[model samples]
Target: MNPVPDLVPARMVSEFVYCKRSFYLEWVLGQFQENHEVAEGTALHRKVNAVKGSVPATSEEKPFKATSVQLSSPELGLVAKLDVLEGDGSFSIPIEFKRGAPQLGDDPVWLKDKVQVLIQALLLREAGHKCSTAYVWYDKVKRRVSVPITKEAIDWALAQVADLKKVAASHKIPKPLIDSPKCRRCSLVEMCIPDETNALDGKSAQPPRRMVATDPASRALYITTQGTYIGLSNGVVELREDRVTQEKVRLLDVSEINLYGRIEVSSTLIGACLERNIPILWFSSGGWFKGYASGAMSGNVDLRRRQVLASITGALDYAKTMIAGKIANCRTLLRRNAKIDVEPTLTELTRALARVKRCKDKQSLLGVEGIAAKAYFSAFDAMLKAEMGFTLEGRNKRPPTDPVNAMLSFLYAALAKEMTVSLLSVGFDPYQGLLHEPRFNRAALALDMMEEFRPLVVDSTVVKLVNTGVATPDKFQYRGDGCIMKPGMKKDLLRAYERRLDETIIHPVFKYRTEYRRALRLQCRLLAGVMMEDIAKYVAFTTR
Candidate 1:
């Protein structure tokens, strides 16, 4: 099926510059993992995100508290929680906190990071913050560098977003560009296969799957040849069926046949095509297409199984309430001091629930969260660093440079993967999700379900791991384009992750306790029940 256009996310500039396969695996397959450099970077960022202080009167003077924080842009479709947003008593400067010492002003990623800052600058303007230039705070040098968000730079980001959308719309997977050194880190290198397959040894000839058609333009003939008629489309086709004269085409001598698009195949046509064994691409729309692909129906009928559960209202309400309850549970898991961190977000989460529940369709509900999550995430990022005793400072995009985004993208993948397994067990197809776009190989529905549980599972575990030292310096590595999980670290992380899910939580509605993993499965079954008119219990989950 052709993916509906515009459903895909408008990716940031970073994804295009990085390895396409990584983009495919991440943005497409939604698989994510973490390594060593990333873990340390997260720790370092906590300080910068919370750093108090402003800007110098001149280039030499010291600075104080940042005024404007977390600037975003709609046109560029980029949102960043900037480190030093307010500047020198007046000007609106977008300050980026960097860990690597300092480099000649020409480094590519530095330049790229700058473009993002520039986009934020324009966004700040759109959001009503007056600004001229942006700055990068280099932790190593302990100073900020000036950058110009010139017309040229802003112009570049605009062009890039357009290009990104174009590429996203074309769902084809092209061959790997082995020429780029970046390919070394691609997750699908094992599956995509760089080397060409061996040719069949002509010494042992194999039969072709198809026979050429006879008609010059129509190409309607199959493999059969009734007579050795010379100039039979200038090719020889073996004959199997009897030569016959058809009323429509007059007398024609032919044998077995395999026509192309020239004819539509039906029971009559299939009988002929099967006698001839011709392959064709079957077409359908909507659930019919789904049922066809599943091979559960023979005619035009589609089998959309109804859930056996009868209390749909209860199940639906349960799904939403469980989600909100999970969010509340996460708040309890945070270190005591972080309780201060919970109140505002708890408010927003509640607000999002109202917004989420009020949603008339899945797409609108998704867009609401997409925007809400972007804004809401900045707060959580702050809470995570403070409670875990670390910081997450950096840009949020493909191959994240900031600590928070890196953690977020990785956690999103891990949590969603677990939910995919959960949904499948409950017989709710993950592909037919509400919030996320149905991209090739992407489990959109699974992503939608994962949103509510993110804080309870991934976010909480990440903080606990960092705070308790269960996940430490040696567990991460940063040699690649950016900090990523060490080679063997995923197994360890997943173990910790699974353990966290297995940790029991009191069920508010069930009047009992259950593992988070099982809870996820029950949620899916409840959603299915809702669609099948089996239950009425459904509520949008929020704070935990």
Candidate 2:
């Protein structure tokens, strides 16, 4: 059980009154994602956050005003950082700054804002100053609304604090609001997933609105050249080798960094990436995923606890769902792309998918998956144009024997790495999985998530590369019977893989279009929703 915080911030109390689930996500789970509104609010607070003056300790002091005053009250179990505090040697007023205009009603100030200021007033009174009223400064309209701090208002604020404490101690996330207008512009809307959660939980019958962006503003930065040095300078990432700069990219434009083989990165850049919550993935030159370095682990302990328990008790159920989705997707891909006759293979895969539901345990599930995979891979070569000179003699890995197999192996590893990053971002333990058994140094959960995406992402990319003549016979070199992609070919493959990720497709369930990259995170979040019991079941993404 989690312990309740000793002192609740006045801001959080306001947040609780506005939306309980949002407060729980931000305060309890430590989940926060900044959007344009939040960024603008931060910018607006810049001058006010710079502490300028102090609140008078005694009533005998002369009149003074303070900006950015920190005060806490143990007796009231409250803390606040006032944007502005004014005292005239006898009475004090706490002023809170807001980015937007005041509420449109008889009371210009919102109840949440009023409660926050009242709490701040109580904190000031606890500091031995006479406080009776507070003010809310709305910067958007340059307006100030006065809120009288009455005994009744004090009681209401305290009551809210008490209720918040109970909710915190309970460790049960509050249900998201249904179809609220407040969700449209909320910075945490994507994380909270209010509409999607409510729809999945059967609380709402409407389809969820498209809250997330079609394409991310920032993208992954891949470093593949041998002996490349990555350093930070003036908010830019500079790739230097042999003391000469090869490339430069602004830090703000990079969402994550992927380093392959013998690359060196400066500690400063790594620290900056950590501060920004950007993951750095490590891979071998042959596209083998090694590991990753990240900052603090996710704070969603309850979800992970549930995941561990489910992995122990209910692994087979999840395995069936994911494997069934995988087989269905594989059949769809073969049906849509295969040039040759693949009716028999498609029928066999459909039968395998049906067998998935009747599997008794993990072993049976694996057997079903293997059968489906064999049937799917049997017709995989027919998906590509025969004139491209690429043929796959069934899927082979760990030193793929043929060029097509090598490319497929590399792209699959990249997809697995992408899933790992997505799972980590959604606060899942990547090593624990349902379909794939956890092994030492293996991201089994990522592998499990990769099942449904392999045919849609990696295999599709391989097909496009082969049919478009981007990958040719000369692009591969054989080393002791192991086919490996040459340097130029590896770069080409990465480009094609990223392009596939950027492609937008309509989600089968949501009836909305989103990029494959964003869909990865969305699927992980949906899985989390199921684990958290906000949703009835996990719905695997299967492209039509």
Candidate 3:
């Protein structure tokens, strides 16, 4: 059965014909940028599309030429605005204007341009106009190329649109083309990163996809209010403010939904989420972990048993590696952000890294990790400007008595929730521990996994917020021997956290740039692979 797209813009069909990944990147990922070629193309499009009124007949002009003919067909769910529609009402033809020269092959014209005009022709046919043939006018060579609107070409274009609909259904970005020349001219080169990722394509045994979600490109919806209710309506997740609908998101576009405070969710929404396997995380009004709920687990039982066994008996090596990564990342953060001379702190962290390699058990690993953390936090106060008044005396959790501690603790707790979900998605039992002690309700494994990212994601974000005066002392309320964020501060911090997660960095192992959220998921998957002995050694994320 062919999947029909909800709406197919005729231009996107041309993009689909040109490069599938470009279409996915542009439409699905909502990513685009303007390069030289794109700017030039835009200028050309403006010039061609700006021809107002009828074309005056010259020696070189066609008998009947009209500029910018708009047409749509509800039956085919297609829409197009041809650059020029020629001939008469009885026998009209759509002519597309191309910025470049006509690309002629065994076929009459370029398939991308051909399919585009064919769509315009189809739309014209549905709108009660005769459209048997179409023409493409090339500006560069001043040539007119004819494209036959044959059944074979129309069927092929329809099939392509159906495939595009299937891609939309998945909500995952399609892989880049192998050895594509179009990549060189693509405006999204930096975003797509085809140069580095494409290197893996030639290999017979390629690495696994480096994201944890069922669909990596899907967006997460966060609800912070207490009285907000979520329900399912017409294949979309509806957010209501006390029974009045506020926002709606299609079910397929949501990867995860996080509910904070006393947000109410109906059973129908839960069932919809379960059917789609999107995890829902619950947090306190103050951004503390409350609980987690999700659909059925998808990891292998045997692999999980092996992971549990490793955590219980043989996790010291993994702990040492992860701790080393954490300490090294902490040093890097200090080196990058510290205003004063960071040499002393970096030297101490270097010694801690050396001590990590020699650690034979979890206790020694903790000792080294502790020393590195102490040095890192002692220098943390110097990283910020004095005007910001955000200072870290030490790493404190429970009450987070200071402003810096309050923000850091909240960020860490949020990070733990993300790591917990990521670990669970990759089939790891969050309660099992490698470094942190296992408790009945504690997500010890998630804590262990988040150690490396604490400095990378949380500390870096805190530094940026504090340095930029984005998080002020007034935002933190001191009461009852503890400091907590106000409502405004909480919103600002959530925004900061989400932005940080979207930031991309080159992966230490994969050597390809990926979002921090995807990196977190990738790390969990890599750990799972290590436990399953699919990979010889576990490599934790580290930064320069």
Candidate 4:
């Protein structure tokens, strides 16, 4: 006997008919991003979504109009919360509110809309109400189109429901649409990356179209004060110190909350952040990442499962690609910024990159990476101005001996935290790594991904801070044998780091310009695509 299918929302059936890939991403993977159109549609449905009135069971009851009328059909394995249900005792009409205008031709309703309303009608019928017709209200044109609920339409809708269940159960993401007009208006276009996937797979000859904006509108909120308390007040986040309000920000404006040192957060505020899908990152006073609190793990179980398998099977090619990108970027940074002749160091890095490609196992890859890192950092002090009174003996951490290493270590910690968040957002097991060995409480996958970005983001930021005199030797203090940044210096470094993340660069592979922050998430999504076998191979981000 076949397994019983899980009940799906009627809206999902409509989505499946519209775009199978989209349905899979949303229904199966639990991914969603709101665009302007979606936002507008949400605004239009505010009243319709509110539950009011009720659907009567008997013809003897008086006529009534219900908003947000929920109905279900067990035998059909379907459920729907209809926008509006207009009913007399004997008959009922289901109405759906759409944000866009109706179709241009004789069949004025879109197939997806028709199927959606028809399914709602089917649910009403299952609930013992006679629903012969449905109405679609196009808020854009302020017109209502009537749809006849017929046997053929009901059969087609049921078939789509069955197909959608099969697709969901298959755990395979459908191939994206090729240059379809539907992509232009889709909110998930950025997540789907249709053209990019096709281009990487060699199915498309053209470069991927930049269909969606890459930069995030929301920004991370950093709370660094030692005794700050965070609380929620009427949709605003309030930061208080000593029972006095220090700052208030609208919750919608914050994407992530980064807390450093001794900070208190109210349970209400935490709940609000979780509801909005904003992660709260905890850090020690010295800028070491502790952990993060998020609402729930990403629902992309298939991707995470594949990640675990790949980790055990030894993803040698992925390891080589990441390390090669790291070595290449390190060489580029040295060549671009080194004030002294470092031709030998450059040659050694090139050799290391060559060795990375030839390595047969993770042990050899680690050896090559160590050699490349030593060669790169051997001449690291040459990149800084001598007048800045800063020098690097080599990369030192876990109590960096010098101001340069201290700053580098701090910035590296920040970069690792960023990678951790990126990996979590893409539904990967941040603790499972292809190159880095897993340790208790260590995000090895984040460490693996941050290798390529260390020189490009953190190291570059450190050099800029030193050479520009934004960070001075006076900003650091010696505690025991370890050097640490003063509180003021820590603030300045964070500001510079955020600015660097906001800086835009052209992607060497996609040939599109995007901010580093978005690029991080984009790279994570691409990595997930590789794990899911949607893309031909993993391509690490490399700068020119």
- How much lDDT does each candidate structure score? 0.48, 0.88, 0.77, 0.88
lDDT of 2 at 305: 91
Write model 2 residue lDDT over 127-234, tens digit each, in one string: 888888899999999988999989999999999999999888886778999988889877788888898788777887778788862226788999999999999999
What count of clashes does model 4 give?
A: 0
Summarize candidate 1's per-residue lDDT along 1-544 as a digit string, tens digits: 2232332232245555444544443453333333333345567678766746543433323334563355455554566566666645455677766665555647523645665576667776776656788877776677777777778877887776566555544543333443343333433332222221000112212221111112212222321122212122223332222333222321123322322112232354434433432222221110001111121111101112332232222233333343445444444443342635456665665576566566555445556555555445545554553444456553364565544455556656656655665555344556654545557667666776876688677877766666666655565555455555542444445567768777877643342455676557556645644453333445444332
Q: TM-score for candidate 2, please give it.
A: 0.98
For each candidate, C-alpha RMSD in Å?
A: 32.7, 1.4, 12.0, 2.0
Task: Kindly report the root-mean-square deviation of model 2 from the true structure over all alpha carbons.
Answer: 1.4
Better of 2 and 3 by lDDT: 2
lDDT string for model 4 (373-422, tens) is: 99999999989999999999888888898998988888888888899988
Displacement of the residue 24 alpha carbon in candidate 1, Å:
41
Off by over 4 Å in 2: 213-215
True-vs-predicted CA distance for residue 126, candidate 3, Å = 50
Which parts of model 3 are misplaced by more than 4 Å?
1-217
Candidate 4 TM-score, C-alpha based: 0.96
Give the candidates in order of lDDT, highest first: 4, 2, 3, 1
lDDT of 3 at 372: 86
Q: Write the per-residue lDDT of candidate 3 for residues 1-544, one digit (tens) a residue.
A: 2234566889888998888877865665444556766766778777557655563322134457667666677778787888887766346778887778766566657878988988987876676666788898877888888888888978888888777788765634566665566776677654454433444344323442332212345777888877999999889899999789999889879978888798999999899888767888888776787768887765245446877888879688889888988998998888888888889989999999999999888887888888888888989987898887777887877788898888888888789899988877666788888899988768999999999999999998889999999999888898898898887887787789989999978777666568898788767856765664434477778989
Q: Any idea what lDDT model 1 has? A: 0.48
C-alpha TM-scores of all predictions: 0.39, 0.98, 0.62, 0.96
lDDT, residue 428, candidate 3:
78
Give the local distance difference test score of model 2.
0.88
